[model samples]
Target chain A: MTTDLVVVLDADGRALRGRAPKLASEQLTAIYDAMVRSRVLDEGASELGPDELSHYEPTHGREAIDVGATFALQDSDWIVPRKHQPAALLARGVLFEELANAWLGKIEDPTMGRQLPGHYSFRSANFLSTSSTAGSHLSHAVGAGIGARARGDDTVFLTFCDVQGTSSNDFHAGLNLAAVHKAPVVFVVEHAPWEASERETASATIAAKGAAYGIPGVRVDGHDVLAVYRACREAVDRARRGDGPTLVEACTWLTDGDTPAWRCEDPIKRFEQHLAHQKLWDAAIGQRHFDTATAELAEAIALARTAGDPDTESLFDDVFMNLSPQLREQRRELARTATTTTIQP
Target chain B: MTATETRPGVKVMTMIEAISDALRTEMKNDDRVVVFGEDVGPKGGVFGATAGLHEEFGETRCFDTPLSECGIVGAGVGMAVYGMRPVAEIQFLDFIYPAFDQIVSEAAKMRYRSGGEYTCPMVIRSPYGGGIRGGHYHSQSSEAYFCHTPGLKVVIPSTPADAKGLLISSIRDEDPVMFLEPKKIYRHGKGEVPLGEHTVPLGRARIARAGTDVTLLAYGAMVPVCEAAADAAAEQGRSVEVVDLRTLVPLDEQTIVESVKKTGRCVVVYEAPKTCGYGAELAAILAEKCIEYLEGPVVRVAGFDTPFPYTLEHLYMPDEKRVLAGIDKTFAW
Candidate 1:
């Protein structure tokens, strides 16, 4: 018998755990500090900065970051994060420097800074680069998993998104390929409570949709890292053992800040308070972690302010690796004639 | 004279066989090379160009794909992006549309969008053009579609030697290339193709036959048609220079304009529809840049504006008669 759907919620909607973890923590201080830093990064990042990526909207729902799903995989496993959220990458050992560098389109960043802030990729980590269009990256992750399995290596691949991003042929094609090929790919689809303006009806759950394609779908409280870690561990174990693909709906909430134009849920503040109440961390340790995050972020901001903006030469240089003879001549002409161009603050 | 045996210094084999020999040679030369497509594995291609390929290379390198064109192309994109020199076959030109998304979206944009970080130096092979009784679906000339797309190198071979030599060169190129094999001329046109090793440079147009009166710019199956047209025009006391544009996207405009300036009259020929065809593009360029050198109106010998008709396909096709007529009209002007 299979469970239709599973929901793991903590009191105060903060520490929801859908699937519990099989792995034990070696660093309580480090994990707590990392979560504190993640929360600071979230709080510090201005969601209202600018509509830089105004072209494509989240297909069916407001973008919801799956909090607990990123930490459940092994060290060698690949994670294809399909959103701007850093919760998963944070767990996967992606540094804030690298994420920010990639976001700023720096050359040293993996994927050569070809991606936007949300779509992250790492060559060394084996993370498949994300595409701007919703479903293209999903299929690629599936292909990478297949390639890994073919080599007799059992490294599981993970991609986390929701039904909002799946309102495209890309999703259907990628998932279909994974299902038909029995690739060792586990999908974490975080369903939003609302679909842009429309509240999500029962029809939008990816579990029902994924079941139609022969991929086993599991729903868990996305808020609880332990619950997500536990479920994902099982899926990863099953995948490593050649059980084929799995789809997980980690039921999460958007808690940053809710607005008329968009919705947000403050997941971090609530979770930390729960940890304190349960004596998971002493009040002093928790306060210091938050204070350390604040100081480090302040230093990053100061360094960014002093580092200065990149010049216009980057525009032409970044376009090609080796410029053609004609393009070389054209660049010489641009140097001789075109006026200096600068970026505004 | 037998086509396969060299006439003292020349050997002639079918175009498809030359392609097979080239692929075979290239694979042996490089260890990282792989070939794939629908029906291209153990059974070879539908045209037998990849015949005996799987037997020699094993199914790992040379393999058949599921009937999904998009998957075939997308998988090639992935593999190429992963640093393998992959040669993906689209089976037929008409069916290559399903992979156009992969071509234009992922393959073409990878280098540019990555700011030169990642590139897919992959080659897509498909049999294109009409002359055989393939009618609308299979026989349609689709080179113009790829020609209009930027960041893609498009190559078409008119002879057996070129078919093999160019395929080898395209595989080694550091850019995405659409290698269109004229299906009608695959076995129909035979010539001596160097067997040992050879490479043809891309973005260069060859003056197939040179003369003075008019310049005939053409490619693919139409190279033969233009040769016949030039021969027919020569009988009328009019000499013609034929320029075979092997690669169309990054066109050899300099070569074309130079040939046109010398001839003082020009005619462009292709098998695709007359409107928005490669011929029209050439016409516009000549009119704008080489207008003073042209002694006559640039005439076009191409397929009709309508969809390729089934029964009237032969008539709709730009044949020797139509090409000759077009040349004659341009000479008169």
Candidate 2:
């Protein structure tokens, strides 16, 4: 079945009379800035040539879905991002230097360069590390949501995935468990427009699949930042009010082609035009945001390049609460065979 | 004999009852403890290992889940990470294949991968090993698979007392533990158990019987088998030391190496296949740490490298006869 796309903005960036001022002017400008920054980072990251680093799929055109869904969450709420969505971390205020160092597998990364690039995690920010395996983090989100309810904390968990991820058994298992237990979770699916063949072969729309698990499903125009934000805000509110999960499918076009039409459809560009129409954006303001983001990213890249690799002796850290006798012996053997170097504490 | 007391003033129970008691005690002490699996609630578990938990803890805490092993374990990992002590059952260790990814990839690696930011403090319990005519599907010693994975604790209890104590420790541990119950002796192995708050710590091996002639290292069902073999060796005027390695992953290397060093002869016994089995690890450790102390080559008495057989179950398992033969061969060598 075909689900209608929920849109709140017209082609000319005019909102309906009642919903025009739902978001404060400052919030809208911040969302636009975040989108621009994310787009710039993605473009620069993609330009970094092969240097023994694993390349992650760029979140080039899906900035609105990333920033909107993340901005709607409270500090207590949790977000489990997919492996490719670096914007989720950027929206959560992760430092660009940390992201750069993590991508370079340097010692300064929080995970000690263990995780791949774009798979960011910050416990203090309530953002879970992305699991490389598709659909694995869905159940973890459900569990966290249930845990929140059990602790009498009205915290909601939001997870992001793609159209193909819904086909995994873990996806169904998580949704079923959440529906049965009334877990406070929101599953946001970025339904890329280029996946028409995938959608055609599927039995139903990704949103409709939520109904089978007794969850409320809503589809939105992903390019419209206000629409996506509104849908996610409603879902988060419902979850905090003891209602079960909601599956939000943000239908978006993949603007990967080097064409002007694709560039025009960019979520960042669309939001910028909308802000300009509202007199909140101009050439000076746009240039300031661009310059700040470029300078910050350049500084982060330089810092990451100077960071050294993790010490060889530190390979046995964090494997368990404490190293067992076997591990201690193994570490000793490794220390004896390796060149001695000072390890960071 | 009265069912109440096998030994005066002491309660004698089977290994299964000891496991149930451990779960009950932990659930009573800590409200975060939860138990769930297929047929574990109203049906009281397929083997009655969780017989009274449902009636006592109520449906919310002790419940049944869909027959999805992956979901059962994956949810357990999530719950543990979210600050719940979940005790998930897999019915049989043979059925744990579907949940292997969740156990190895997610649960085991949660702390390490998250750089110690998150941890999965959960316990996965399943009845394992051959005997009782369970054939291939129902009976298989799969401890080696989990022991090979880092960041996971693997435990096996041989007697009723160890079952109660070790399980309590596993539930209270701050890491994911794979508790494999020896189904072969779950009912037949009854012993006097210490009542109330008894906990045998993980990574400690117990000397069932001390001797100087040979060191017989074993765990799980093989513990009793090796004990019997020690008794047989005593009849021949050869003293045999039996060391029960209750936990495999965090192996008590000091105890194992010390025992082999003192005896100068070692025989490792397990019901799993010989090649690349947990016994191989014991042999390698012995070779690495106690090679000079050994007067003979380290021997292994284990099941054949084949699927667990149905009617030939008795022959496939490592019995007292095979263990004794291994001891004698090592002495001759």
Candidate 3:
């Protein structure tokens, strides 16, 4: 008797080592640059906390969201960045300044000072918006895929972190909708292990979890950008060709820089270590990329710090597009209330 | 907007046929119309409301779908938002809960969220209000579930004419509508449905019977029950007015409050269970908004608190006898 079981990266990131597939140096450089930028942006940005204070705790365990997904989707394709996907959003197209401003809780933040800090949105970028509600936004990504298929656009990329604990109805509902519609969405569930909490997934393999839904699941080494890119590309192309959605499990590790809030280990460093042995590029070039990113990020951080100064009065707008009579009166009262009050300063 | 008065005539047709006639006429008039759901296509729907649909229009217009309710509803939301006036028929309203997220959140909210950037101008028609004994899973009165959600227009018609007209109007309403057809009334109840294309705008109520002493606000299968109760009340020398709220959600509050004002006494009736049921909404609206107009407390006659019981369905449902008792309670008060 034969049993079918799919493996989700059974190999250890520690023991496993392989040479990258053939690619031009620039293409290789771009992928490495993307990973570096992802790390730098991920290092600087605060994903989940109070509106003004993201308190940048780097992403732990979910390196695939950036290194893999960046190469997974085409440059023009839109990506809806969930609250935790700072690395993914940075790789997708969000600038360091935008993430910083968003963290500072500036008026210019795409969330319009409404939702919390990590929930960024850009309507023009094809990416709709992100929310803290666990898997509720996936359907919109699925809808974007449906639109992509109709327009003959190549593919769309979507990312999520599955805690198994947040196995709320939204998670099942979102994925089931994608699977049933056979929408052109490639769901990358960063199989978050302990740190968010120490609980392991009920299943040993992501493939086993995905197989329950009759979707194909493949695990990629999250630290290896080339491996992640290759795996995501296959899933995305399948969706673009109308074959249907694929669930990719990119097994990753949280590193030293990772804080409990939003921690991801440096894929660039790991990839560089791997590439050094493979004789891909000089170690100095990789070091320069890191040096350049830190310097640029420091300036961007200062600009974000001073540029956005929001007071209590700034909170009044966007509650309702056109404030109702009742709301207008409330705003007036609040303004009067604030004016009569004094500051300790 | 024109009153194409349709005289009453006895027409023996299945409830499914009346629904088919409604959908067929609407599809014929509008080119943007499309229909799809589980077992809906080549199957003409499990009951055949879409029987001639696939034949009349191409498979592209009417088709079968995967057994995914969320997928079906979400896709319908997408199609409705884009431009196509999609008529998504959930094989049964009982199965619609799986897709409740899209129905209540996305479809109902597209217009408001987009600040009118888009609208889910579509119709979600399903067999609802289980008088046919579809068992616990198959039989349920779920209009109250959709009515509670805003940005969704809910319509449940009791007669053939209102069924056809309200359905047509719901299809074109520039809003998402949950159009529930009383499964039991399809063949058992009959009246004249106008021959040509017609539409009954949403947010309008019809007076089924005019009486002075009391008002009976009812809808769906309960309309006939209220009518029967009015007759029984007449036997007791009690004059009762019957108002059929054809569209329940935008809920012609004026008609309800106006009728209550004239009658002085009112009993809100429905077949859905008593807890958080649509009748409660009606009763509360009357009590707070139309309190001064009422001569007595508004009584609600509805299904029991239990899940729709199969054995005692008669007892589980609100009938003429129970409705009259409710009216009696109001009068006594």
Q: What is the TM-score of chain A alone in each candidate?
A: 0.76, 0.92, 0.78
What is the per-residue lDDT of model 2 for residues A1-345, given as tens digits with 9 covering 90 to 100? Answer: 222667777666777566543778888887887887787787678767768347767787788898999889887788877787778777777777878887888888777778888777678778776678878788788777766665677888999888767877788878888787787889998877655525543544577888888899888778888888989999999998998899998877422333212224677666777788889988899899988998898899888989998867557877888888878787877766667745332
- Writing each residue's lDDT as its tens digit, candidate 2 over B246-321 gives 9998999999899999999999999998899999999999998889999999999999999999999999999989
Report the C-alpha lDDT of model 1 over B268-324, residue by residue, as the tens digit.
888898989988889998997799988889999888888777788789878878877
lDDT of 3: 0.68
Q: Across residues A54-151, which tens digit of lDDT does each residue of candidate 3 receive?
A: 44545544454565676567766656445656666656556777777766766556554444556565544444455455555555556555545444
User: Residues A223-342, candidate 1, lDDT per residue (tens digit)?
Assistant: 455556567777888888888888887654332333222234444444555556556656687788788777776565444334433444444453323444334455666667657754
Q: Estimate each model's TM-score.
A: 0.82, 0.93, 0.76
CA lDDT of every candidate: 0.69, 0.84, 0.68
Choose the strongest candidate by DockQ: 2
Between candidates 2 and 3, the one scoring higher on DockQ is: 2
Model 3 chain A: lowest-lDDT 10 consecutive positions: A1-10
Error of 2 at B208 (Å): 1.4
Name the docking class for model 3. Answer: incorrect
